[model samples]
Target: MAAKAHLQEQIRQLPHRPGVYKYFDDEGIIYVGKAVDLRKRVSSYFTKQDHNKKTQQLVKNIKRIEFTIVDNESDAFLLENNLIKQHQPKYNILLKDGKTYPYLCLTNERFPRLIPTRKKINDGSRYYGPYANLTAMNVVLELIRALYPLRTCTYNLTPENVAAGKFKVCLEYHLGNCKGPCEALQEEETYNQYIQQIRSILNGNLTIPKAYFRERMMAAAQEQQYELAHTLKKKLDRLDDFQAKSTVVNASLSNIDVFSIASNEKSSFINYLKVMNGSVILTQSLEVQKKLDEMDEEILPPLIMQMREEFESDSKEILTNVALPSLPLPGVTVSTPQIGDKRKLLELSIKNVLYLRKEKESMNDRSKDLNEVRIMETIKKDLRLTELPKHIECFDNSNFQGDNPVAAMVCFRNAKPSKKDYRHYHIKTVIGPNDFDSMYEVVTRRYRRLVDEGASLPQLVIVDGGKGQLSMAVKALKDLNLWGQIPVIGIAKRLEEIYVPNDPLPLYIDKKSESLRLFQRMRDEVHRFGITFHRNRRDAATLKTELTEVKGLGPATADKLLSKFKSVKKIRELSEAELVAEIGKAKARVLLSYFEQQEQAAE
Candidate 1:
């Protein structure tokens, strides 16, 4: 109680200005938070009643509070993010998959080398992209190499070394891939011109190179250098292709950063797009786990600052989907446009974040499917089956008092239902709800058709009964010469026991095992499907009988009424005019009188 009052008193004394705050427990810093007003934000924790369990626990454990007043909200945001990155506070949200993405580095040297790196150094070098993946980075590097004859050797390329003629040109120079800068065969000024064009291309500005190549191609053609002109044309074509693929936005909107966020109950997804000279130079999507229920206004600003620092974005203008509070940063404009190209760019960023969210969901679903496949393979090995049950079909018989007996077969492919492949059968050549005989007929009919039609077969077949049903299915398979070719088993409903042919002892799978759960799912699905089909058939039969009993209603009339109205009750409820339109007036009157008499009789 004393601690609570003291914390509240400290909160009341807090300055009403932008700052970062740290919550301390006995062990260490439990959480770090930032706010525009130190007093209002810090006081809310002790005053508010509706915090999430994690936040509530954090507040409970707070033994001391510390804060540092910043100049404004932007500084506080940057400071808070830096502190969180450094300390990784227990209660603060953190990026789960935070690792530096790869960048294409152009080294700062007389003969600079183009290489892919994961680290960014500050030694006067130019880096492009923290590219989304290595393949993209490699594509850019390949394009650069094909267009320009840059030196691949790591020679000093110092004026003194070249003057003394101390180095020799390598095989790259002989192959016409390098300009032989090591042997002073290429002028530094000419090489740097190529470097400048390459840099422009990497920055999503291809006009410089395209124009230069166009001029060179025309000059070579005028000089009657046909081969050289063709080479230049090919380079131009490559540049055009690269540019066409790279640019996705309006060329007039240049030097802007796009940030958009999408959040759910558990995590937030933020996507960043760096547009330079109207081309997207960099793109990244990051997911941060939500440790507390923080609003987007609170979550996005800090993330924007952090991403700006991480990507080293210096764009003065940032576009978002919503208006942001003014930041303390000098000369930065954050705007949410309602129309025009900027709005379109904002929409694009939102689209990217949504796509990334969907992609992550799809990836998680695929991972789950892979795990299920592994489980099924384990089941196959454990059961000593001939093949993995990539496709499985389960059969169950349904009947109520030997009326409208039917069977259903549910198909499972890759551990999920294939509804299109499911089959339903009306009992033929079997009667009185004999489970074994019904199983025999269904299995024989299913496989015989597959064999005759040359259709693919399931690796495993399941019968939803015990040993008797198993034996019957085995006989049917043997009749079709498929007994030993396909594995068949039966599951008993009472004990959930599995029975195999010619095996007296039943296989009792562990109740908690995924294999058993899979079998249970198959059994339940077949049962449900069989029951639904049986019910539909039974209802149709009942309707037909009831219609036949209606006086003055012929079989043809009954069929037409059932085809139109679908049921006797529905036909009875139709207006006299509607009924007359379907049948004749005389039949319509008769139908109305019959229903009236029935209602009166019920009363």
Candidate 2:
């Protein structure tokens, strides 16, 4: 029989409920999928019109179809994600290029110390970051060593085991980054406090450390320890270098993800950035389209979701490899909040995107277009920004009926992703697809940190949509007492129109202008960021929701099964005995009965 005929024949056996489906090519390579309505979703492949080139090609390669019915779409989605990760089917675009992201580790010893490593070291000490870039991570490490002057010796320096002649402080002490703790030149109590300060700063809680430093400086001055006070002053000056990079202000937010999307004639790029505490931790870039092939839905939102899944998986790997610091205060849970420092971080991500776009435009033309330079100059003047928004920031929101509402901020420094700075925000405030509320949450979370610190701000802020989002962001700035001082604009989707704050009709800068390209890129990146966050949240929610409907399953058991097996097909492959061995016999039996009933219903 023809491939379509075989698929249609198989579809006739499928249940009209949530389930996972698999397609096998002649070589028996399997591609896995999940659908809310397996019967309807699979049947569309055989009967639906307007199949894209990728789908048609997929259809042609299929030699057989297989499916397992589930109780709901949530199960199907979870099963599908797991299956895709396990089988790595060619059809599902897999994210996370396969290696775990790196994180800084500090061993849990009586004498805790910091070091750079990828694997999780849960010995006892604090872990600082799954930092987005190695430079940023290393810079913090260097700063900690310089400012704290703690030991970095590899020899066993434990109190019970320290040998008189076994070890001494390395050359680091001579260079002034260490306090020579190896030789007991530095007291254990004092060094311990310095280590605490380093960990605190890396976790994005600096207020306590700042205060501690001030108190110590004052105490030294009162004691007439002129040299010690001056040294403390120098250390305080060094702390400013940390501030020179990014100023993250405190907000009541936790664990928020931000995203932004941008596109040109050839391809669209979505940037996903996540902030934990006040730190910008990770950034991801997703290709929205490849060649002429594209997804059926409009590109912005779906692609963003795809990136979020990739980034989230990466995040898990990071967390496992790096131990989290203990919360500074009780009742302060970890949350990806929607306001304060989080919002500013999101805006910085957008500027990174715009900067890249502008760089591309400038290089595309052999000659420096004077008009382009003028536009750039005008942007600098209008924004009162120090640099030619040679770096720009933008924001956008994506959601489906409030379920997976998300916001993204992409950076365009010199018109490229700054891939280092792009961020995604999982919307925390608005539900039910309220774009304005979502954007407001994102802006406030991202920027409140910077505003609180009184740090220099991004050159410009752009929104992916039109006046409404721009006004929403503007209102946030104004409320924070940051209105006219910073430039905010919007990019309308249909005509590639630009809307600056207070400007009514859309403004179209020259297509060839670098400044225009920069703004477009920023807008696109934020859209991509927002969409990716929404999709991942939606798919995750769907999976969680549906899995709950299954008998004899709780969230813990479901999460374990999904994490262990990663797919329904794999779960199906396991015998009841194997399942019972992993979970309990009772739960295993319940699962078996559930699958059996679902299969029977499909039949």
Candidate 3:
């Protein structure tokens, strides 16, 4: 408590300005975060009572707090990203992927070779991309090879080596894939020109190469060389297909970056698209596991700065679904579009982010289902049960403020609802709002019938009320001599404390535990079942009472009308002819006359 008071005093001294803050425990920095207002953001940790498990643990460990003031939000954003990278605080979100993306490196060698590489070192060679997918890099490499006869072999190819015949051309030269640059048969100037053309294409400009192929194809056909033209036509088609697929917006839109973000309780997803010449040259989608409960807007700016640096994006203009007052780069233009091609491009980026989020959620759901099997194990441990509660039943009693009392039992098998085994019972032995008596009657009837029929019994039984209801259920089980054969417990409404058969004090399960969640789900299911049954019974009773007042109409006839129209409201709306066809003229006239008088009296 003294430590907490000191921390509160420290928080009171924080300035209301934009900055980065670091949290330190005895071990070291556990978390680092950025905020628009230092005092407000840092205060929220101690001020808010509701936090996720990880946040609670983080707050519990903090022994000290520190802050660094920045000029504005942009500096704060960049500083936060750099600090996270440099320190890698234990509680900060980080991307899970480890594969370094591939790049097309133009090597600094004689007759420079085009190479696909994952490493970018400090060489004079220019690196084109850190492609999100290796396949995109390969397609570009294949197209470059098909367009120009570049060397594949790695030789020094120095003037002295070429003159001394240090290397000879291999099969590549014969196959028309290389121009024999190692043998000095191809000039350096000519090879460099082809390299320049490849660079242009790599920058998402395909117009020159496509035009060159089309012109050559047409010229060859005019020269009466059908085979050569056919070959050129195929290359042209490949280039056309590649261009068409990559061009998402107008082809004239160049040097632009688009970003979108989506977040849920656990993680944030961001998608980036680098557009040049109106085609998508690079695409990346990243998932950041959330810590400290950051919102979507708060998470996006730092991510944008990080991704822009990581992907080497130099676009002057950016499109995004999120506003960017925090990202105040001097030369950069960040805008959220309402209408036009820019809006479409922003929507496309958002679409990719949403799709990625949905895919991740589906995978998490599958993982959760597999993880739920462990929940049964957790239940077994938490309850000190002899075996896993693979089959469990929960009981709940419902009424309309002490009328129409009923009880329901819902079954769960393998941590999921087993609706087929669910049972709803009218309170046959209990009068008024006597939940304990109703629980006793339902428990005895349910298990005795199961025992007589030789049906499998549930491993665990739960009653919705506290010790009173649990005592009744326990008594029923003992009378049937099944008390020790099965486990029965009750949950109190106030704190959800679990009461066992003979225990005076309740056992408290962790609120965040999946076992507790499973228990809560069963409680909810039984409550729904009981309430629905009660409503139907009460409604049918009222309808029967009114029908009994119709002189010739009995409950049997009332039931027939209810089965057909589903409610008395619908039965009262039926025409004379419709009612007569069902119950004959005499009974129909009496029913209609009674309904008319009832409506007139109400009016």
Candidate 4:
């Protein structure tokens, strides 16, 4: 109690500004976080009753609360990343994969050999790609071999060694695989030109080599050397094929870094693509496991910083799926591209992450835990819920031009739909296209009635809209005192940003995750259900006046046909045979003649 009082006092003294905060126990700093408002954020630890288990435990151990005020949220995030990494906090996400990837090292020598190596030493060697795809790297190596006849030997090609006749040309030279720089059979300048061209290609500038080949082919043709021109044209074709294979966007993309992230219950998978001239020169994927339930927004900055450091990337422009306020890099432009070449690159990076996520999931499926229980566990972890969401319900609102406003709730148990528990709600209190108020009213009515009837509430609640609808739902939950008893999430339709109640940043579950698929399935089910109900209600309101007036057709038959077909417009589009199947031949002919008379009158 004394420690709690002390921390509350400290939190009260905190400035209401954006910054990073640290929690310290008797030993040292154990956890770190950032917020746009330090006082409100830190105070939530004591005030909120719905802290997750990890957070509750963290709050219990915090003997001291320390914070640094920054100018904005971006700086706070950057500082939090640096502090956690420097202190190695116990309750921070840990980057786990430490395996060294292979890089194509071009040795800084008289004869630079393009070779694949995992170990990097600061010996003036230019390394390209810690390639995520080894086959792609091998293809590049083969292309380089076909383009240049560089030596593969490790013999010292020093000028003194060659001048002293210390080395001799071997079978490689005879096989046209080497220009034999060891014996001074190839000049250093010519060998360096070959290395330079290879270096350009490695850096994803096929323009250099392509232009070289094109110019040579043109010169050969101009000199009337048709056979030589044909040979050069073949090389040009090979270069074009290689370029087409490597490039992910238009040929103008250069010096832009791309990063995308996907996460499941425990780990975040990040894919990084270093683009040069529309080609991905370096592709790498990393996994970071969560210990403190950090969000994608919190995970990405450090991941980007760590990756940029590991690869020594100096690209001025970075494209990502998540939006960052600012980066530690100076003079860098970071954007989340919605459309254009950069968007395609970002999408390709996301595809890479999705593939990695699927591969990891496949490996996990080999274990025995990938059943119904595992799905609930995954939902619990991925959504950061305190308990398993075994019985989940999702809500969606539907309206046609602010008419016949209706909402639906679809229930799922054990990761499958429960049609018996499905509900459709008509808008009663609110009118117009106000989804926010409609959601609040529906949630209040549903849960309050359940409470009054002493019925059990669902383990999880999901709303289909962005922050506005989510906030309304949360308000309803709080008003009913069900906030701490149940967990609710909202899924935005377009971007799929999962909004939680207190957290400002949204969570992005992996696109391929079963948990996310469950949410989507529930969402889609509600949309379908809600729209169907809304249309029926609207038609019913119309039929009370319009269906009774159809001449020679009794109200019973018109109501039956309209209710079955749902609308008169749809009934008109039906074939006579189909209409006969519903209302019989004589009625079908009368309805068709009525429609024909209406069309003739209009004409």
TM-score of each: 0.62, 0.51, 0.68, 0.56
Pairs clashing within candidate 3 = none
Candidate 4's displacement at residue 334, Å, is: 2.5
lDDT by residue for model 1 over 529-592, one digit each (tens)? 9999999899888988877787887878888888777888898789999989998999888878
Largest lDDT belongs to which candidate? 3
Cα-based lDDT for every prediction: 0.87, 0.67, 0.87, 0.85
User: How many pairs collide in each candidate, listed in order?
Assistant: 0, 82, 0, 0
Candidate 4, number of clashes: 0
Any runs in candidate 4 off by more than 4 Å, and if so which? 1-3, 9-19, 25-28, 35-37, 66-75, 96-99, 133-136, 217-234, 355-366, 369-603
lDDT of 4 by residue, 292-371 (tens): 57678778888888788777789999998987767768899999999987888899999999999999888887653458
Query: What local lDDT does model 4 show for residue 89?
Result: 84
lDDT of 3 by residue, 62-84 (tens): 99999999988878877888888
**TM-score-sorted candidate list, best first:** 3, 1, 4, 2
Tens digit per residue, CA lDDT, model 2, 341-375: 54465566666655655556566663455555666
Candidate 1 vs candidate 3: the lDDT winner is 3
Name the 10 consecutive residues with the lowest summed lDDT in model 3: 92-101
TM for candidate 3 is 0.68
Preferred candidate (TM-score higher): 2 or 3: 3
Q: Could you report the Cα RMSD, in angstroms, for every candidate shown? A: 10.8, 26.4, 12.4, 21.1
